[model samples]
Target: MKKKWLALLLGTSLALTACGSNDDDNAGKEPAENKETTTAGAGDAAKIYENKCSSCHAVNLEGGVGPNLTEVGSRLSKDEIEHVILNGQGGMPKELIVGDEASKVADWLSEHK
Candidate 1:
């Protein structure tokens, strides 16, 4: 019957559409944890900043290509600092940073201010 054939064709089409959509969730994605954040030896933010942030921003507010990082803690909250470091701001580039490495650098920046 025409009705039976139409129903079977519709069911097959729906199954195919659903199967294709399942791939959308995994489109060559990378995990956020895999992104590298700042890292310096000796296991602390100060060390991380010394190695990573010091290249651009001066800890004492002497100024550099980036803004003087002094008082950064007072000016920006921890979340703000983390966002800036992770996502970047103004002319800053978005460097690869994530997970504990990101937290360590944020803590170090918070203390340096």
Candidate 2:
């Protein structure tokens, strides 16, 4: 076991040193590409909205269980959205999905609004 461990260590050490750290050099060399660009377009939030929030927001946000969220982005910041999502105000149902789940929903709402 000791010999095997030493051999593995030696093999990895040589392989690692042989590979230069060019990642940093190449990173900033190219003009920034649209990393956010998604070929599928938008995201699953749209579907989530249709399935979930639709009970309230009603797509265009004419009216529903909650007030119209069409202008939610203009009114609410990402942090506010997260807060509301986690802690629920008036009648939002405190911290539903949690963590990044709320963030994804916030971003989705922001885009539509």
Candidate 3:
């Protein structure tokens, strides 16, 4: 029984780690051809959130590993949200998105209230 429990724990850990692995293989390198070059907007912000945040924050902002952000705007101002996005907080890693992309996402999320 103890061996079975240990194995299960290890398996779960491995699975979570794999799921959380960064997909950005070319960090700090030139953007890929498929990458969007236009100015970030509301729609782009949603896409960014989906690709970079949904794994933990949930696609619907319903929360999962990260806190629920359905009404984050009511809780935090746009500046505060942007700060968190740039600096991270608690279990979240910093700079998941930056620059205009981060600003746009923060603006989009700030409207959730």
Candidate 4:
């Protein structure tokens, strides 16, 4: 019984750690060289999504741990998306990608519909 409890505790801890936000992925990395003339190009935004959101949201915007975002634009405006990104909603943690980057991502997502 004690061993079973210990195993359960260990598993829960690992699961929580995996789900927790990880903000250090790009801590020391330099900005990308490619800069689009537009406010937020598809390429740049997609890259950001891949780096910061793909784990839960999926690379194709299909549902994973998070809801499907394929038609998110039809459901929510850029401002709403930005608000969610900044403040988090439901199970999502806040400030995953703050500042201009968040805005850029919201803009890109707003075009999905």
lDDT of each: 0.70, 0.67, 0.87, 0.86
**Comparing candidate 1 with candidate 4, which one achieves the higher TM-score?**
4
Question: Which stretches of candidate 1 lie above 4 Å from their native place?
Answer: 1-39, 59-61
Candidate 2 C-alpha lDDT tens digits along 1-113: 99999999999999998895867766755443433222223546665456545666687665587888888888888778778877887756775545555677788777655
Higher-ranked by TM-score: 1 or 3: 3
Error of 1 at 92 (Å): 1.0
Which candidate would rank higher by TM-score, 2 or 3? 3
Q: Considering only N, C-alpha and C atoms within 3 Å, which residue pairs clash in candidate 3?
A: none
How high is each candidate's TM-score? Answer: 0.57, 0.53, 0.65, 0.63
lDDT of 1 at 20: 77
Hey, what RMSD does candidate 1 come out at? 10.3
lDDT of 1 by residue, 1-113 (tens): 99999999999999988877575686896663453532453467666666567667765545599998777787887778889888988888765355666677777667755
Clash count for each candidate, listed in order shown: 3, 1, 0, 0
- Report the poorest 10 consecutive residues by lDDT, candidate 2: 32-41
**How would the candidate models be sorted by lDDT, starting from the highest?**
3, 4, 1, 2
Q: Order the numbered candidates by TM-score, best leading.
A: 3, 4, 1, 2
| Candidate 1, run of 10 with poorest lDDT | 32-41
Candidate 4 clashing pairs, residues 3+ apart or interchain: none
Q: Which candidate is the best by TM-score?
A: 3
Put down candidate 3 lDDT per residue, 1-113, tens digits, no spaces: 99999999999999999899585886776655444433333548888898889899999999999999999999999999999999999999998887888888999999999
